[model samples]
Structures are given as structure tokens and as C-alpha cells.
Target chain A: MSLSRSSAIPRSALTTMAASRRTVLRGMALSGLAVGGANLLAACGGDDDSGPSSGSGATVKFGINEADGSGPAYDRLKGMADAYTKETDTKVSLNAVDHNTFQESINTYLQGTPDDVFTWFAGFRMAQFAENGLITDLSDVWPIDGLNDSFKQASTAPDGKQYFVPVSYYPWAVFYRKSVFEKNGWVAPETNDDFMALMDDMQGKGITPFAFGDKDGWPAMGTFDILNMRLNGFDFHMSLMAGDEAWDGDEVKLVFDTWRTLLPYHQADPLGRTWQEAATAMGKGECGMYLLGTFVVDALGENGEDLDFFTFPQLDSSIPADSLDAPIDGFCVAAAGQNQEAGKEMIKWLGSAQAADAGNNAADAPFIAANSGASTSTYSDLQKKSVEVVSAAANIAQFMDRDTNADFANTVMIPSIQEFLKNPDDIDGITASIQEQANSIF
Target chain B: MTDIEQTRAEAPQQQRAAAPPQGREKKLPTRDRWVVITMVTIPLVLVVLLVWVPAALSFALSFGKWNGFGDLDTIEWVGFQNYKDIATIYPPFWPAIQHNLIWLVFLFLFPTVLGMLLAVVLDREMRGSRFYQTAFYMPVVLSMALIGFIWQLFYSRDQGLINDVFGTQIDWYGDPDINLWAVLVATAWRHTGYIMLIYLAGLKGVDASLREAAAVDGAGEVKTFFNVIFPVMRPINLIVIVIVVIESLRAFDIVWVINKGRNGLEVIGALVAQNVIGEATRYGFGSALAVIMMLISSVFITIYLRNVFREERTR
Candidate 1:
């Protein structure tokens, strides 16, 4: 029976069957390719021929940091583009790239064939490009309605000319679930002593007082920023980030010393945990609070109905705790682009409340629009609180990575902060190492 | 038949016709000579263009400070300042060197020895040996990035299998004091499969009569392998050693996927990528690190080539 079974499938017959199967697969693959090609051609044709012209015949190329088919973020950007095309005669063409790829290759991209307007962060990252003449001066786009003085300050480059158009921002604050806070009879602290007492109360109840993670090496910078602002005030913190102040000075040491004292209240072994895992712990009621941006809601996969936040309370009576990190996201026009006037005109409209509403209505998750005139009816409770807290602040600092030189911030501060996290007692050693590297880079 | 016979008949005449002028050496036709020259020149040009030019440029760039923003004329010549800063100020540099040496030593001690033992045992034709071979070699088929993610399931502190199973909260990929050793353990899982497959192939090529002769002379199994089989596989042993050395020097993708080589997982390759490939744009500093890595690799490569040439001479 075995011999007959082996002889039943002759080698030539098996080869014929395999060949037929490959032929069928090839036929299917060709049809799939034909359909894909037709779709691509149709997309290209629609972009060139279908849009109505009301403002001008010019087409402004926009380089977005989000990938083409990515969810809400891409949808919001596309919605704004479509809205602008309808309001104006000029056409907007989008060139979408992955977020990390766009950032890493930004230097080459700006120097090479950059699009007319591109998504970017406000602060030193924008100023660097402006200084190098890679981006156009958009001073004419300024005095935009609904954008206040703080937004204008964030948009201006080092040369006292507007180089960026403010779009949206999110504030970093101490976030806690309202249910957890109410269950524990803890109100948001108003002073340094009250904050300490709140942490003690949480610890006594056998819950970690804070959810902390620094595995990606950037989250810990948020802690340092708040501590520095609360202890040394806002201007000193900005000077320190700009490499004007010595890193091993007394002001910096005090920030580290205060943070070290509070380390015990944080969740242990944070280097192994990601921010999402830390947020999960807070959501599960294992931790009492977390200090992160409002995007922490996205990590917890909820609409943030249960979430509420307060600015970190006063650590020193002399230094008002009114300064906070509220990083602004915006757009810049490339100097090398072919249609500079159209790019400036589009960005001018992009900074308006109408553009903000178009984006918010399209996306499932909405950004906190930078324009104060933007509609607040669609904001979640958490986002509404964020908008209120941010506007009330006396000084708004961009986060550490965005405010400083990219080289020093990435290579020096990231490792220095991680080292401090690993060994909190070595303030002198860590600060000295940072100063030495900072001297070399700056 | 006619073509073969005609070629045979003409071979002596052609050789005789060319030999007189060239002093017993037959010359090639112009077309064949051009083919020979073209084959040799193409690879020579490619190697010079792709490999040597970049290496030379890296060495030159190491001496200058450039943020990769402008033309070549914008590069400021800084002499050896980059190398000085790397030695004195860069904190990750020394740790990365120590980790690389540890990687080399650990690979030699654990995976290389373990793989040879498994290869010898599997050569005995025991029951289910095929199944054992497949199980041992499966990791070699996977990429290092995939291996890192697969092991992350076991190494993650809160969500991993190891902590869950053991009820211990060890930070396998986090704590600086222990994470390097933890990463090395994961590395050995993939590396053992690779070394085992190479040794298995080497063991198969050993002459059966040499083993029989050893047994006939009253040698035991271990004794026969050590005395007769091991020395006979000298070329394969050298190849395996070179491979392990090369692999350790270029060890990057796994640790990079884990944490971008921060915390406890820094290596030379990762440090280079951190400076050059990211938004840092410290091209001059990255080139210095690359040059240092190249110098370290050339030392091992030099020793390997010298030994190989010495063996060839003796043969």
C-alpha cells in the first residue's frame, strides 16, 4: 500500500500541478496590480483637475509629518487642507511622511526639495531653521485674529520676526482620576505643604503616590522642567536650557535635591515601564496621580471623562507657580519652496478659528486649539480644564527638548536625566558631567 | 562531433603558433582579454567606491566640526578636539566599549562551547535527533529585531512571562547593574542556534574512518572527538571564531530596538547611530566614534587574516 501511494503521485504530474498553481497566483497578482494602479492614477487625476479655483491658480505644497492613511491626526490635517482649498482659490497639495522619518531627516529635507509649508514645533527648533535661512520670514502673516500675545511670542524667531504660525498646544500638569481623588477625600493641593500631605495620605493608603516612567528618556525631562520652574522661576529655567547658566550651579542643584526627596513616592523600577503602562497603573487605581500632558487620556484609551488635573502647586512662596510647559505645534513656510506667497497666505488662514473648527469637527480626538476664538463646545472636560489652566499661566515654557539645542538636549540631557533617575543621590556628579558636555556642544 | 574533433585538432596548432613569440605561454584573443579586464575592473571600482571611499571620508570628517547644514567649505577644522571630547566628556563611550568586550567574551564562553557540544551529541544519530536539530536551529532563522521583541515578552517587568511565572519584580531590561547580562542571555538564545548549525555542518564533513581508527585504538568517545575530530576541523574552528568576533563588533539591532541603547544597553554601533542617524546632526562626533569602531574591528580582522595566511603557507 505504501509503495502504491508513493507511485500514485508521479514527479512529472506533481510538477504540472505546482506550475498550474503558480500560474493562477500570477493571474490574481496581475489583476490586483491593475486595480491598484488604477486607484493611484485616479487619485493623481483628481488632485490635478477637480478642485474649484476661487482665490488664485497657484498650488502650495504642504509637507505633513503624519503618514497618509494614519488615523485622526492625518484626518485633522487633511480636513484643514480641504477647508482652505474651498475658502481660497489656491490648491493645497499634501506630501505626507511618517512622523519619525520626517523629524530625523528634517535637516536634509529642508536643504533639499522641501514643500512650501510644513508642520513643525514652535521655539528653538523653529528658530534654528529661521537662523539658517531654511524657512521664510512670515511677519506679514502676523497680527492674525484670535491669536493672543503669548501665541505671538511663541511664533516669533530670534530675529524678532514671525517665522511660525501657532496652531494648537497641550499643557503638562499633575493629572488624577476624579473618582480616585474623591474616594480618598483628596482635593488638588494649593501649596507645597499641602502637596506633601497629599502624597503622604496616598502612601498611607498603600497606593503609589505618582505614576512615573522614563524608559524612553524624554518623560523625565517634564519632571525637571516643573521642578526648575517652581524652584528657580521661569526666566532662570529658560536661560539654563539656552546654555547661558552653568548646569552645576546652586539653582540646578536645588531642583535635583527636591526631586530626590520626592522619589520615594513614585512607582519603583520606572526604567522598565513605558508611559502607557504607567498610565494603566493610574487608571487601575494603583497610583494616585500622574504628571503628564493631557494626551495621557489617549494612553488610557478613554475620552478623559474621569480625568482632572491641576498645575503643580507652589514649591516656593517667592517664586509663583504660574509658569508651565505648554508646547505649541505650528507651521512654517520653506524658503526654498517655489510658491512662497501662497504658502504664507495658506498659513495665515491656517492660524484662524475657522481652520481650528474644521480640524476639530473632522477628527475623533481634537487638539486644544491655540486660537482663543476657537469653539470650545466640542472640548472634553479635561481639554477644557487644560485650556483654562494654560491661558491663566503668566509664562508658558516649551518643553525641555524643544526649547534647547537639539544636539545637547538629545545626547547630553537625555542620558544625564536617566543617570539621575538610576541614582538620585549623585546630583553633583550628574550635573558636572552635564556641564562638561554642554560646554563642548554650546 | 565535428566541432569537438575540429577543436581538438586545432588546439596544438594554436598553442604552437602563439608559444614561439610569447616564450611558451599562449596569449588570449583581444575580445577574451577585454572580458577579463572588465570583470576585474568592475569589482575593483565598486569596492573602492562603496567601501574604501566612505571609510576614508569618515576618517577625514572625524577631524572637522560640521552640523551637515552647508557645503563642504563650511566645515570648521578642529583637529583632534572631537576625539578629546569623546574621551573626556562623552559618558556613554567607555561604557559602550566595556559592553562590547563583554559581549565578545560571553559569546565565546557560552554559545560557542554549548553549540559544539550539541553538534557532537546530535552527530550520534540518537532518536528524535532531527527534531532536536530543528528546535536548536529555529532562532537562527529569525532576525535579531524579531528575537528582541520575542524576548521582550519574557523580560518586561510588569507584563512579561518571567516575572509572572516567578513572582519576582526583577527589572530585566531596566536596571543598569543587571540589564547587560540580561541582554546577553537573550543574545545567547539566538547565537547558540547559529553556532550550532555551523558546527553541525563541520561535524558532518569529518571522515568516518578517522573516528573508527580512534575507536580501534581503544579511544573513548570524548577522547576520539578531542584527539581526532576537533583538530581535523581547524579551518571551521577559525571560521566560527571570526564570525563570533565580527558579530559582537556589529551587535546593534537588538539593543537599539529595546531602548535606543540607553540605560544599560549602550554599544559602539548604537552610539554611532544615536549621533549620526537621529536629529542630533553631530556628524563630526559620530564620525569619530565610527573611526574608533573601525580601528577596533581592523585589529581583529588583521589577526584573523595573518593566521589564515600563515596556515596557507604551512600547507
Candidate 2:
């Protein structure tokens, strides 16, 4: 492994400058073969690493999950690349792909010849790759100023080394329209009794307390994550995701049973409605509140200016409401990347507030940068609030999909959750099935 | 010259040449032999590599656990563990099987019969018959992905056209009980056009004199169709049945487009894709699902082939 790592440094640099030029020529010859089926792997490998401009300066390929053309995310990434190039003289080649497609193809993208630095999330997914040697060890790049210890903890793998660099993040919370809440004389709850009373009050007024949807099968995970964290605490939630705690245990049952009591307060037949449609309901004041990530603004669109959120109330007094699902989006250096030095340098720079400032300045949709030193002048009220909520949280859990094995989460948990939605009464059967599958997978 | 003209000219010559293989072999030029070899070998190689190799690989992978990364050495052989887990613990497996069977039966019963009836009606060459035929065939030209999108406009619960029209909310795509039937209706809309087109072509080929003779014998249109035209159109009927069976078994794209085959739309194909495609590379588990699907397809293939061969022998 050491030998392989040592050899990769020069190999990547050489490949960037030399092999890239030859690949353009080879790509033309092999286009016919590549267009067909079997040689696609070879074709993609040739296209991703290097571009036509084989400049004398160091080059790092940055695999961006956002698509090309005009978008805030694309502009932000482009700005980051330009800044990185201007400052360090390292050409950052951006390979932009559609977000979902990028996610679905991540396994192949990593195992194959991946870009030097690629966008990723900080959680169990990152740790899994780190354990499998698909990502480079980035412990040396840590101690970046303005990034708190919580971000570092999220970035660290089980091996006691960091594999990720936190850039931007968004928190999951109970969001509502300010005007609607003000008109109804409602206040954000702080305790279990307060929350229940608030729900009852909303119900008495003929308003659905919660705008819920699970048609896509992932939105409900936010609800489960928050509920589990509040009831059993973050340690138990993490263990549950890690396949350590019994899914069929009393703790999990309590979470579901508690959820069942609150189900009546949520919008009916959520399996039919998408998260966007549900968010729109809250935007229209048809529902009292929505529990989701800060990106729920995308669904609210222009009306998002009216949006305000509060963290989910404390369920158990023993466990404070300091934990929340605030999934951090970041970057990782691929183990298979040729230019580890350039990649590490790029990652190190990315962790700094300067990079965040550069990224935010480039786009209309400014991200709530992870670095405390990042500029806040351009931030929207919501982005500023998101930063505050995330920073104050003691323990942050990445969303369910990011916090567990991909196969278990996608294949087992998605269907399992959908089933639970259809038949909320069958908690025993649902938990048993989840446990059985989880046991097999783990 | 056009393709048909060229084929017409070459047809007799090719047939005459093929009659005596021994004589042709001796006289066959080296260039022609090379061309023939290349033509046969390319398809043969393609079929083996594209179809047989993947099928065999899936079978082999079913016995091992792999995440579709690293070298072959990374595959840990777990014997029948994946299969055991699927049969015993997997929630979607049983539903996928049931859905597939339901799809087959629904297609055969509704679309096949509806298509035949429409073909019969359109065979009369009434005024504006061409317009009706074109209108009926329109959905067939649209891709299944597009069809799924079109139906989503009508089926959405909160703001769907169906709810607006009826003033009643029905979860068309979300309710496990009704979503299957709702999707089947959309699928049938497309299938009906395809079957109708095939049957129309078959109807046109049925000798008109037979119908005239039935009419002379005091037979009505219905009697003539059942007694004379139907038996004569056995070949076409058989083809329609085969097409329906194949379409039903391979029903995937529409359901997949809707929800990746979740929430009461769990087909075998979608389940396989859910596991194997994209980043969810549970190679062993996915392969087991695929192998089971292949076995189910083989049963249908065997029955179809046997019926075809038996018919040929009788003829």
C-alpha cells in the first residue's frame, strides 16, 4: 500500500501532462469502439483525468456533482476552480455531472480512475470509502482555522484520521412561514409538552400541524433522524445507523410509537405527495410547518423570503436538544488520483474561509460556508440562520442515507420506510424486517 | 435504386445460388468467403460477449458478495446466502413476483382483446378511418418515459387533472391498492395501439373472397369473422399473443420512471436495476434477483418455443 501511494505522486503528474495529450489522439481512434458497450470504462477513464490544455502548471481534476450550463452551484464551483488556478497556478479541471447521476455512479467513479479532488458528503459514507482505501488520508490537512472541532469530528473516519474537508452544510429543522405563525399567535416550541400543545392548537384551528411527504422515499428519513436523536440521543442514533443497535429493540419501537401518535397531525396520504408539493402547502399556509433541510426554499421559490425555522423541540429532558441532522457537503482526494500533492493542497485551501468567500461571491445562491471566517455580508437571512443553528448544535448527524451503508439505506431502509408509511401500525413487523436485512448486510 | 427494388432483383439470384451449396462452395470467390466470415463472426462475437457473458457472470456472481469494486479477488464467496436472505427476509421480492404475474394477466386480458376489437372495426375502411387509425396509434410512438410523465399530470393527488375533473382526491400513483391498476391503464393505452397496428396489417392480408363467400352463405359480419377470418388469421393471433406476453414480462420503463418500482410497483426488472444499477452495487444480492428473473423468462420462452415448433410440425 505504501509503495503504491508513493508511486502515485509522480505517476499522476506525468499522466496529467503526457498521457492526457496522447489520450486525445487515442480517444479519436477508439471513439467507435467506446461508443458501443464494453469499452465505456476505458473511454470514461480517458476523458476524466486530463483535458486538451496540458499547461506547464500543476493540474487537479475536480469532479463536481452539479451539472454544467447556468446554475448557482455550477457558478460557485467554477469560481472556486478559477480562484484555485489564479492563486496557486494549479489548473483545476471541472467535470460537471447531474447531481443524482453523480451520486448513483459514485462507486464506479471512485473505483475507476477518479478525479484528483471530488465532491462528497462527510459521514458514514466517507468513512466506508476511507476504510476501503478508495479515498486518501487527509489528517495532515487538518487544523484549518475557522473550522470547528465538530466539523473535524464529522470529517474523521473510524481509523482516527480525517478523510473529508468540510466546505458547506445545511440543517434539517421545523420550517414555517413567519406571517402564518404571527397571524395565528403561535410560537416555536421548546419542550415535548409545548410541541404537543402546539400541534393540538394547530389541529383545533383546522390546520395540519405538519406538511409531510414520502413519495420519493427519502424525505421521511429527516423526520426519523430527528425523532431518534431527540428520544434516544445521538450516540444511540449513530449506533443504530452503524448496525450496532438492534433495529427491533424497545428504543426503536419507542421512536416509531411516538411517531405514530403524531402521524394524525401530518398531511394525509403523504405517499402520494412529493416534498416539493408538501413544502408548497406550508408556503400557502395550508399546513402549519414542514420538517426538512434548509433547501426547502427551493420548493418555496419566491415565497421563501417568508420562511423561518426552529430546531425540533427537546423530547427527553435527560438528552438536550443539541443534536440535529446537518449533513455536511465536502471534498475528498481519491486514492486512485495521480496528483495527490496538488489534490491535498487544493483540499487544504478549500477548507479555508477564503475559498468559501470566493465561492459565495461567484453565485446568486450563496452557501452557508462551514468556515466561521467566511464573509456574511452576501448571505440571505435564512443562510445566516442556518449557519447559526448548525454552529450551536453540540452533536450533528448526517441525514440517514449519508450515515449508513449505501446498499442498506437505499435497498432496505427506503422500502422499509415506505412500508411503514403505508402501515404505521405494523411497527413490529417493519422493525423485524429491517433488523433481518441489516443483520445480513452488516 | 431503393432497398425494395434491390432486394427484388437479388432475391431470385440468391435463391438459385443457394440451391446447390456444394457447387457454390467450390466456385465461391475468396473475397465473398471473407465477407461472409466477417458478417457471421461479428454478430456471433457480439451476442456471446454482450448477452451470454453477462448472463453467465450474473450466475457466477450470485454465489459471491461483491460491491463492484477492486479485483476479482475481492469477491467473497457466500454460497447461497444471498438467495437465502432474499427468500426469507427481503420485503420487495414477493411483491415483485406478484406484480409481474399481474402485469402479464392484465395485458393479455384487456389490451390484447381491445386491440383486436379495434382492428376489426377499423378494417371496414369507413369514412375518416385513416384518421382514427392514426389517432389510436399515436401513443405507441411516444416513449414509455414520456408516457409516464403525461400520466403524472393526470395522477398527482393534490393538484392532478383527475381530482380536478372528478372533485375527489384519489392517490393514483401512491396508494398501493390502486397505483398498480392506474399504471396498468397507462401501459394498456400504449399496448393497445401496438397490438391494433399488428392486427390491422393481418386483417388487410385476409383474402376478401373468403368473407364474400361467408356473406353469400347468409353469414353476418360477426359470424364470418369468427368462422372464416379468425381461423385463417391464426398466424397473426399467435404473433399478437407472443408480443403481449413479451411486453408484459419486459414491462419496466414506465414503472421505473414513476418511482424506481417502489410503493406497490415492484417489478422484477426494477428490483434488479435498483440493486445493480448506479451506486447500489450489491452484486451478489442483485445477481440472485436477476437469476430468478431469467429462470422465470426461460419458462415462458420454453412454452412459446414449444407451441411454435408444434404448430410448424403440424403444418
Q: All candidates' lDDT scores?
A: 0.84, 0.84
Model 2 lDDT per residue over A305-360, tens place:
78899999999889999999999998999998767888898999999999999999
Clashing pairs in 2: A12-A338
The C-alpha interface RMSD of every prediction is 19.3, 11.0
Q: How accurate locally is residue B191 in candidate 2, as Cα lDDT from 0 to 100?
A: 92
Cα deviation of A284 in candidate 2 (Å)? 0.7
Model 2 segments beyond 4 Å from truth? A1-56, B1-34
Tell me how far the alpha carbon of residue B91 in candidate 2 is from the true structure, in angstroms, after superposition. Answer: 1.0
For model 2, what is the error of residue A337's alpha carbon versus the real structure, in angstroms, after optimal superposition?
1.0
Best by TM-score: 2
State how far residue B294 of model 1 sits from its true place (Å): 0.4
Stretch of 10 with least lDDT, candidate 1 chain A = A3-12
lDDT of 1 by residue, A1-442 (tens): 1211111111112111112232224323333333443465456543354433225666888999999878788888999998888887678899898887788767766765568899999988789889888899999889999999999999998799999998899999999999999988999999989999999999999999999988888888999999999999999999998899999999999999999999999999888788888899999899999999888988888888999999999999999999999999989999866567778889999999999999898888888999989998999988888898999999999999999988888899988999999999999999999999999888
